[model samples]
Target: MPISDFRKKKLLYVFNVFFDVNQSGTIEKKDFELAIEKICTLRGWTPNNPKYAETHETMIKIWDGLRQRADANKDGQVSVDEWCSMWDDYAQNPDRALEWQSRYMNFMFDLEDASNDGSIDVDEFTTVCSCYGLQATECKTAFNKMSKGKEVVSRDEFQELWKQFFSSEDASTPGNFIFGKTNF
Candidate 1:
């Protein structure tokens, strides 16, 4: 099945706002490296830390998976067109993409769960988002929407949202804010 317009918009938002970490208009190794650096810095992780090593390894794996699956031209980068094309195929059965997507979802959630309590509070969410170049105010607002007034969002709840973010077509779903609001 083809990707819906709404899903396309969401995907574009992710590609433009999140994946293109260096504002280079494409997804590349450097972008992933920059993201890993930012996340490591936010977590106060260094080369000597286990967490840093694990995070770095996971991100590189993700980058490898993405390049393998999405770099249609094998040019060492994923262009926006290729990104949409890959996601269009995945939209047919989101579950097929779960192997890689779940890795990313868990990585993100763990990164935000700085308290290591298996839940993400607004402050933790905001800090991580800010490291990604998002405004703290926007991150806070997005957190409210995502958490649905809960003091903290548990891992299960976040997992559901993560699934929704990848599969749901409804605009009202809180998962729409998973990476914060997209400017349409």
Candidate 2:
């Protein structure tokens, strides 16, 4: 099935607000590189650090995957239309969606687990969202909703929420807030 308007908007919000780090109107390698730098900077990882090198490799791999999968025109960038269309395909094949989205989900959860406690507390979620330019209050609210009254979100719970974020069409679903305010 085709993605709903709300789903399209949410995907676009993710693309424009988060992944398009360079504000280049499309997602390109530079966006991933910039995101790597920002994330590494936030994590205090220096070039000599193994984690920094790992981050660079991981982000580049993700960029290559996205470019190969979503860049239908082979222009080396993913535009909003291509993004939504790729997601539409995913929507039609949920198993494939889960498989493809798992890597990103794990990366995000691990990144958000700043304390390395194997779970994401509200403060950690808030901090990550804040880094993405979301309001602290909004991040707190989103964490509360996504966590569903739990003190922290476990990896399993986060996996479920990640699936919902991509698959659920309902606007009121808690998973919709997984990335903070969706604006739709």
Candidate achieving the largest TM-score:
2
Total clashes in model 1, counting residue pairs 3 or more apart in sequence or in different chains: 0
Q: Write the residue-wise lDDT of candidate 1 on 7-60 in tens digits.
A: 889888889877898999999999999988887887788989998889889999
lDDT of 2: 0.85
* Candidate 2 error regions (>4 Å): 98-100
The numbered model that scores best in lDDT is 2
Q: After superposition, how far is residue 18 of candidate 2 from its true place, in Å?
A: 1.7
Candidate 2 lDDT tens digits, 1-184: 5678888888888898778999999999999999999999989999999989988988888888888899999998999889888877776766666333667787889899999999999899988888889999989988988998789999988988876777788877878888978457
The lDDT of each candidate is: 0.84, 0.85
Clash totals, every prediction = 0, 0
